[model samples]
Target: MTTRQNSSADQESAAVVILGAGPAGLTLGNLLHAHGIDCVVLERSDRAALGARARAGFLAANTVRTLERHGLADGLRRHGRPHGVCEFRTDGGRFRLDYGSLGRRELHTVYPQQDLVADLLTHYLDAGGRISFGTEALAVHDADGVRPVVAARDAHGRPARWQARYVAGCDGRHGAARRSLPPTALRHQCDHGVSWLGLLAEAPPSLDAVGYATHRSGFAGHMARTPEVTRYYLQCERGTPADAWTDEQVWDRLDLRMRAADHGPLRRGRILRRTVVDLSSDVVEPLRHGSLLLAGDAASLISPSAAKGANLAVLEAELLAEALVGDLAHGDATALERYSRRCLAHIWRAQEFSRWMIRLLHAAPGTDGESFFHESLRRSRLDSLRTSRAHQDWFAENYVGV
Candidate 1:
């Protein structure tokens, strides 16, 4: 936890104090509200910031069902696009997989995370759910004891304490919830030693299917965000600034890596945003720490390679909401005790798939011989995935299941 602000006369209270107002927090808030449980969400960002903070866009089949089941997917059902095919370009050639027909026969709902968050937020507020916007949660005190106290600072810079029976940390990895964990708590992480310059362009998508291009230079990817906007990714140096390359340079590099000459050219437009994302994954063990429970990115940070971060966040939020409901509304604590183990199972599975995706997309970081061998292995893996129905089935199931 960071520096704590002493409690003042303006003390707040809730049955559960949720930190961070992302997918997990807002989803949990809505579920708890429907269940008649008193919970409040504390968010450091304003509502406008949340409505504009774009992230992952691929929502798994399970995620859509979960949101719809809770009466919170009207926006998603109305605007989300169905996507299932992915084209992989390699040294030899390119192959497209119609994953919607394989494995569990599930397809991804391509809805921008910000739009989903906006929908969740709107539904939450409309239902009279309580949330403290622009309120920064500094630390959680007495989480090991009954009734934890969350120290926070409001928009006016006033110190406030929220007392709660339980605390849900939907905040990201660096948030106070992860900081407040005991030193003995276990946090496992893997650095893939690669980075991608994530790009958002104000142009229509260049391809109908999702594109994954593996080149001698690096990996380049293309995904459609909307009818008028597209998302692109270009592998870059580890510490390179997002804006180090001009728009033209970025487009050229993308063209080179994506082999636009052989296939087709990308539609160029104004670059809206550039973000550097390091490929890495981390998991916090025993998600329950006394009265404090971790959820979403706070419990696990999965690389965006497989677009699993937001989906995992939504899944974990549903699980956590159920557990919290069981404990708060009823006298049952069985679900609460089993939360960590169950969620970790799903988290680890997603991590394994993400690692596979990283290896399939990026060459290993090493000298000439090592890199060649690694690239060869990656190609072999892709070849197997392209030709083997069994391999494709596995990929499709894992790709859209979680």
Candidate 2:
């Protein structure tokens, strides 16, 4: 937990400077360390805060393979659980899908994101990687030049400068990386007009499989996090506060929406966390500007409907690391030249699937004819998924592909 503080004007140097210590930055740092490349990671939060943040838990099969290939799967392999089933409940009835048995027969690995981040941090440190836990990157300057400068401040409010051959912007959507992008950058964005109240409870999962319930009231989702913890999402109005409802009211609404009378009772416990997440997606074209390269949410912001944000982050990190290594080690810039195109292809694909999942789970909040029409379409899509193998295969493939 050593913090770097420098009030002097002298600049530190590394081959690469990574912003953010989440999955993407840590993955890139670990890979670079293994390749004997010099790199430093800068994170705004302290070590404890970084390791305690909770996020998506579902890891697609391909994501698991990527981690395994990089020798980064030890934590997941030791504690992750394989999950392949998802149950859907609607007014018509309830149906379940064993997604692992369909399409390519792939499954997701359930590993809490906080634990995964802790593991990545440990691995990176063990490899002698340098990470400034409480340092904040203020701006990236002169990225168009061969040498870029990262202006930052340490936890003690002391100014610091980092000069690097290259900069990797893995911070996040609102981080300095995105803020420093030039006006010429192309940013495509969409708002799905849906919001959800995400909750973490200290209760066991109501269902063994992932549960998605579509009710006239709204949508309710249930997913297991750990043996004693469960994740839940309740469709909510766009401006509703996270604490809009009491615990008893929350459970009552969940029961009504999930039709617990016909199904079963949900295990109840203390609600540990609550947050409002609006469904939106955005992507930055090229994903690179001169010496600065972007990865993770800084490159693209995908909704959590499909659990693709973190998976995409790790995938992009690997691609960028390989390209960086090749360029620095052997002066081969082929991979580097095509890194944006390669990662953008996968990012767009995942965005499409995530948008589709958002539509599948949420009904547009309205009583107009257009709203009714969309609801019918949603029902039709669910029916096809329930009755048609072709539809199921398509859903299964996209559901776990990214």
Candidate 3:
């Protein structure tokens, strides 16, 4: 590798240059490498920082099967636990749904996302994968041409370039891949007018199943991340600061909304982290721009209402790898063009389900005429989900299938 500064006029070439080292980029790297394709992954973060990013941990069944098929499930299978039940708490009462046995007869694999990233990183490195950990992609140029080029800055602030036959833009929503798109690309966005005070508690899970509590004050949720760590969410005003509430206040509100007094007291612990997430979703139409393609959050950003972001990323990566492999290895360009369409279909379906979940979980903001109408509908929907087997089956299918 040359360390000289040539104003990026000099460049290195690969058959495919992937930006980002998350699930989408890493999975694509492994598949392409296995087929003897020349590729490299450029990630902005160093290895240690990248591995410490705590993220969504629920993996859909299809995501699990995809990893298993590619010899990538060794760590997940060895350590992940099967989860299939959900407990709902509402003013009407409480109910539990054994979703695993309902629709597709599948369950999610409960594996912390940080651990999964670490595992994928290890697998790729041990297989002689080429990766630049501290490389930051600044922009992509000439994506519509035969060879796309990525402008980048290294850890030492040195300018460099990577020219490739194709570029996989899996970095993220704010990464260079999205920034480099042409003006003709379309971006659609929506804000659900709600926010969540997301919390990470260093305490054992109070219950054995995923819990959704709908209370008059607000919505609260409980999910188990590990034996010692739990994830919780509380509905808050859109502009509330993450630190506005003290630990005692957070716990008291959680207990109130969750009706812990009626059922059982919650296990309290130190709050390790706090994040305020405004509920929003967005999609970029036509995920491909000539030889530069998009995946993961780069293609679409979904609210974590249904926990579909990571699963969708894995699915998109598999589709993209197959398409690229067919074109580069077998001399067929048909699948390359079809890749965007294939991924968009799944993206829309997942988006629909995610929107449904958002509506189901949160109520109308204020007590107005329209608010009552919307809240009534929400309650009716919940009732149907609780009593109607058909509705339950549908929920189970979408919840775990994605």
Candidate 4:
């Protein structure tokens, strides 16, 4: 395996240490590095395959602006597609919410998460940022006099230990850094009881932008990565296996849900990738404890339905970096003290919106007519969102962009 060489001899303890070199960690590192702060990031995987894992692909207008302001948007603009609107379709008809109608600025970007990560990593490396991949952080001791030791083995399976004044747990949900926090800190969690089977393929995009379609059979959402590459998601019951349905079967089902009622081809492509994941939202209070702080997926989760996870993560990292910079400059932790509450103010809003969206689109199990109720509720929400300029503006400001 290929690896980036490290010169740890003169690499004294860094001012800040970041766990997991994902979007959140890298974003925070970039911001801090720009301010002349030293930080070391530990990632469990190697470079060249950072975002190989399946995850969210859409980045909202707010996230786009954040990236652009942070100097990571130049490469993004070169590779991403700006989208104006997103539509919801059902057997009754379709309702489209044109974000452009609500605001003069563009709304969202149809860029894959991997593509965004790749671009950010490239820019980050060129700027002299260092990420130690294939290195695992075994434990975090945040007590006094310890300086928080991060134990791991290097890419060649050599043992390594890193000590830093402060540690940022920007790792994902499953990483040990988040688990290191006391169990009581986890304040809220809500499971939507549904799963989305994501599919990636190199085929002609079916729609001009993002499309949300609902049928009696299920729900299907389509997004274009490029003119030739498309990303798709099909709603399914929790625990459904991808192998249970053949590739042809999956495409046929997608066709049924997304095929235009006007007799238009929804576009078909060969499957490139697929995975299923349960939808859930979680937020841990007081994002900091001792010398450790949680950011991104480690601190909170934005449902895929909301299309805000990556955006929220980016914003969170930005906030944390700002707070850290203030702390370093003024010898005050005021911003750090306010970190969790400030971040939560935005997080809970997204949580509510995402939950509302999940309830609006996903089919309910059993025979309570829950599906019918949700469908009606969705239509009502769409009408209100479209007709009321004030409401639309609120969404455009809060949910869409900077």
Candidate 5:
């Protein structure tokens, strides 16, 4: 609903045009707005529809610090659940990784993605930022500079094109932003056979903090939103369909794999929603194609095993805003050119950690490996992590991104 004037020009223009209104786009837009930069966000979904999307509940210490730097941490800290330790359960027993012991921060928090989105949306809108809903990008032209044009349609179905000094494609994996980039220059991907059946159940979280349970049957984890709501994940066949599962069937499977003796009882409630997705990793080089730059999932993705999705996206948005604003203020492109490189440094490290974590927990199906093999691998890794101060230091640095 916000408008800007374009004098002596038939087309609308701004300092930047961002596609998609997800976390990355909204965060970037807010940062730009704070710096007095003009930009418009075009989203395919209206505000109500955005709440229907999936959630990544974990937020890292660095991410919280970044929000604090932006003066936006009060609301998040107030609503999110903070925990100092993460419980890792296996057939042998459960071990805890205290974030306070491992890193400088006391604990990470779990804030529902919907709540975070609502917060960012509120902050952005309150400041006169525009989010054009029910708009889809048809094409992007001239990525190499002189600005880029986004061809889109409004909610009422009007075709339109807007040009900007730069365009940020925060449109996600399938959006035109990623598709518009030339593949030959920036194709990097890693695929894992694992997939997860994600469920948002109405039941209360079984634990005080995040619990990652690894059992002989499969891998499952518990994440919390509030005292009464929990998010659960269970490993499944890559293409398992939710329709194939009745509520009772789903709960039965979850109850068997996720519940631990330490955790009292598995309480079931109304099944809010469910979906399945393959675990994969990808990063497009440079994150820039002409005037169009990618951020968030569009630029890269990490496995949920790493618990990096929301944190990384928020980090990327903050870095992008700083880079763009710094460049504009000083007439230097250093920040812009270095953005992808800087992000990838952290991105790849998380990818490595996620793969390691998954391997430690999930056994390949039909593997005829001996019990000794599993025990040896688990003990060796854990022992190394515990004894090697340098290695633990590395993990601590990566965990908090210091």
Candidate 6:
């Protein structure tokens, strides 16, 4: 591990300062390092914590390409599995879509995010990249000026300052980057009025394809992580505690909602982790503000319905890295000027598709009349997906393409 430098005595300097060590920050760091750009990654957690944090495992085709282009994808290419089929189940019946056969024939690479992060961390360190783990960025000052200063606290509780030519805010929605945003920034927010209890299980996946089950009780999802691990989601009331249900109760509910009785019993095991995720979406307009730029969850927060978060993060990081290199290395600012517009276009499209997926997989909660109306619309959408090749193609295109 690299020893953190105490900055209280004198301000540290870098060409760029990256906040957070997740996909977006690390990707940006690696790309910038490859281009011989001087940068440092500041992370709030220690190295072990960051390496073990599990997150979205699905990697869009574009994300894979981005990693490959920068020589950061070897780990995933060696360990990740290519997945393309998803199965939907409702009262009507069950059907599967071989999404890889439709549209552009693209497939998602299933690589657990923790593993990917560890890979990126290793590559960055091996290439002599600097990272200050256990450093929490407190705020950004003078972002509107030529040089920005990041106030942070080191793991040993010492105050530190880093002056950088540019700052990349990839620390997430509630990170210091967002907190430092000026009042002039516009934030658009939306709530879908739904919640999901995300679960990680030690058991193997019961089905070969990703499973989406819609029952009167609620919605249940099944996604395989590895041969021994599976991820599941159960629709729950808003504000439900992650530990509201016991492991046995969770399995029973999953079985009922997933119609396992009609199909087959799910392979059960110990619940590894649980969390309640609110189905919400938000976007910050103008991802760039002077010397500070936002990427990943800092720029936009999309529901996990479409598995677009990490994909979008990789995309934004690539774009930002390229634009930064252009401006710093060649003195060209054209790409930097157009970065926000380009990223926003993709963000909006992914948001739309994610919203559509949310509506399709979960029935609205309300009176019987309201439920029936929403259910009808959901059925019609499913019917189109099942019967119309065009609709399936569209779903497949958006499902794997971000």
Q: Write the per-residue lDDT of candidate 4 for residues 265-367, one digit (tens) a residue.
A: 6677688888886888888887888778888898887668867788888999999999888886557789988998888888888888788778667655555
Task: For candidate 2, write residues 66-184 as lDDT tens digits.
Answer: 88998999999999999999999998899999999999899999999999889989998987899987899999999999888899999999998998889999999999988888888
lDDT of 2: 0.91
The residue ranges of model 2 lying beyond 4 angstroms of the native Cα positions read 1-9
Score each candidate by Cα lDDT. 0.91, 0.91, 0.91, 0.77, 0.77, 0.93
Candidate with top lDDT is 6
TM-score for every candidate vs. truth?
0.97, 0.97, 0.97, 0.91, 0.91, 0.97
lDDT of 3 by residue, 305-402 (tens): 89999999999999999999998888888888999999999999999999999899888778899999999999999999999999999999999977
- 2 or 5, greater by lDDT: 2
Q: Model 3: clashing residue pairs?
A: none
* Candidate 5 per-residue lDDT over residues 1-402, each given as its tens digit: 122446234367677888988888988999988888888888989999897675887778888888888866767888887766667666656666665576454467777777787788888999999778898987788877676788888788888788887888898888888878875557689888788888889998877756777777788878887788888888888778965788887777777776544555677887798878688888888787777888888888778876777787888898888888877656778888888888888777777887877776676556556756865777677667656776666565565552
Model 1 C-alpha RMSD to native: 3.1
Clashing pairs in 4: 62-401
**True-structure lDDT of candidate 4:** 0.77
Backbone steric clashes in candidate 3, count: 0
- List clash counts for every candidate, in order: 1, 0, 0, 1, 3, 0
Alpha-carbon shift of residue 328 in model 1 (angstroms): 1.1
The worst-scoring run of ten residues by lDDT in candidate 4 lies at 1-10
Question: For candidate 1, which ten residues in a row score worst on lDDT?
Answer: 1-10
Clashing pairs in 5: 143-290, 143-291, 144-290
User: After superposing candidate 4, which stretches have Cα over 4 Å from the reference?
Assistant: 1-12, 103-106, 143-146, 261-263, 369-379, 382-398
User: Which window of 10 residues has the lowest lDDT sum in candidate 6?
Assistant: 1-10
TM-score winner between candidates 2 and 4 = 2
